[model samples]
Target: MRLQGKTAIVTGAASGIGRATAVKFAREGAAVLTADLDDGATQDVVKEIETDGGTAYGIATDITVRANVDAMVAAAIGRFGKIDALVNNAGSRIIKSFLDHTEDDWRRMLDVNLTGHFLCCQAVLPHMLDAGVGRIINMASIAGNVGRPNRVGYVAAKGGLLAMTRALAADMAGKNITVNALAPGMIASPMNRGFKENDAFGENWNCENLARRWGEPEDVANVAAFLASDDAAFITGETVTVDGGSIAALVRQGE
Candidate 1:
């Protein structure tokens, strides 16, 4: 139980990486607060975790809203007594070319993917400062590192998130708080279902990574658990790529 006796708040816990991370943290002995806009799905995740003999609660939250973010943090502390970690996993994407992207799309992407994290961190950091122990894990993407063609707004938002992660980590130095980010690649998650459904893109994506297949949500969740645990105490200001070597290799199919 790496996270034994801890408490965590995972935003976007209704599905995909967020849900997986919440379940994983609970399984590792952390009391989890699963926050998401999807009330039914979020509660279902809480049920799954509880059925597995883990501790969890569900809250309907829209991280993009300041009031909702504050409420989510308050709920965690009220239910779990203390907040040990905050996983800023809530995100949005706009897969459109730069020329086709509208002002609303750009703002929406930044609002959900970047501003929401800022609000969550602001709301949670005070509690961590009071306790003198905490973890902040931002769920970034490999596309942030190496930009994607059609996802202009998403790339900008995630890239900004990466930069924000480093800056926050630096700010929390020597504070017993570690801030880190996870950059996942080609995960078969609902967020990327549109892209994955395209046969040509999916086939190419399957062969682009060293793993030669799509990554499961569990794969990223496992790493998230480590970051939240004491094992990563000394590790801060780092962006751990959970991409199966997709960022490190240029795989050529039919080689």
Candidate 2:
């Protein structure tokens, strides 16, 4: 009930980390607006929240488009009367080697991962700014900080997202709007289906982290919930890494 009476808009709420965060927000008493490209999937999330005695709604949205982004914001405010938080959790990966990547790959990555965050923030910030308090949570990736194979474009987009999160926080300093990012490592979601299916890759991640286990979607969601709550009122311009201490550990093979 930390978020009681607050309203939150979560992008990419159809599945994976997005769905987990949206559900968690609702559970914490936020009136959640779950936005996703899939209408049916989004509705399912909405239903889940409702079944749990939480307030929520589903909107089919493509965050890369300005009109859709604006409409999503409008609908959220229209239903909830005001918007208090935004989780920029929508993004996809382009898993290709640097040489194999084309201009389209780069464009798509930035459009969905980076540009979408920009557009959503642009659409919702005026309301937050006017209210004099708000939370903007951006979903970044560990690849943004560390090198990853066959993910040049994804790395670039996530890196840009991290930088943008910092810039937004700096710009909003003393304005009561907090901007932050969550960088997750090896979350066991649909996004990492291939790795989960591969025994060697799965084992590597399972054993690399100090926790000796893969991170669940709820792990990141718990942190996001905290950032959205008053408990994190003074925390801004930070990128919290929730990776079971993998980012701090240097586990080498055969050593």
Candidate 3:
């Protein structure tokens, strides 16, 4: 019961890492708020948590909208009493070269991936500050740390997210609030599966990843669970790489 009596809000909880984290939080004794654009899918996750004798609620929210984000934070507070943790997990990727990308494309990617987290954090931080303790985990990518081909917008947005995490951590250092980011490497999510089905992207991904295998959603959820727990009280302003050693290992000589 690492998170017993805590309330956690997980965005993009319709599927993949968000969904897994929502369930994990519930199982760890936190009352989970699963938010996503897909109402039906979110309800399914809520149902799953309830089936396991855990408490959860699902809300359909478009993170790109400031009003929606505000409403979401208010809903969590209204339902669960107070916000203890926030997992900014809603994001998307557009695989296109920088030269080929349009202004609209870049803005759209930033709106969802970067601006969404900003809005959510703004919406929840006041309450967290009032509570005197909180955890904020932003879902970034290793692509943000090192550039990847044909995903300029995603890389830029995630890089911004990483910087945001550090800045916020510094801003709230002694306020009992921790801000951190998770940089996952090639996790096998539905979005990545769609990209992998396309031969070109798949080949590029395989070549870049030294592990030669995709990471599971739980692989990330486990790390997230730890960060959300009190065990990571001393950890903040850091980006934890959950890439199965893909970024750490060196290239073989004759590969």
TM-score of each: 0.97, 0.97, 0.94
Clashes (candidate 2): 0
Candidate 1 C-alpha lDDT tens digits along 1-255: 999999999999999999999999999999999999999999999999999999999999999999999999999999998999999998877777899999999999999999999999999999999999999999999987996898888999999999999999999988999999999988888987876888767645655778878888999999999999999999888999998888797778776
Q: Could you arrange the candidates by TM-score from highest to lowest?
A: 1, 2, 3
Ranking by lDDT: 2, 1, 3
lDDT of 3: 0.92
Q: Write the per-residue lDDT of candidate 3 for residues 1-255, one digit (tens) a residue.
A: 899989999999999999999989998999999999999999999999999999999999999999999889989999999999999999989988889999999999999999999999999999999999999999999988998898899999999999999999999979999999999988888877876778767645644456666787988998898999999999999999988777787655356
Assess each prediction's global lDDT (C-alpha) against the native.
0.92, 0.93, 0.92
How does residue 4 of candidate 2 score in lDDT? Answer: 88
Better of 1 and 3 by TM-score: 1
Instruction: In candidate 3, list every pair of residues with a backbone clash.
Output: none
**What overall lDDT, based on C-alpha atoms, would model 1 receive against the true structure?**
0.92
Off by over 4 Å in 2: 203-206, 253-255
lDDT of 2 by residue, 1-255 (tens): 889889999999999899999999999999999999998999999999999999999999999999999999999989998889999999999888899999999899999999999999999999999899999999998888998899888898999999999999999989999999999998988888788879777645555787778888999999999999999999999999988888797976566
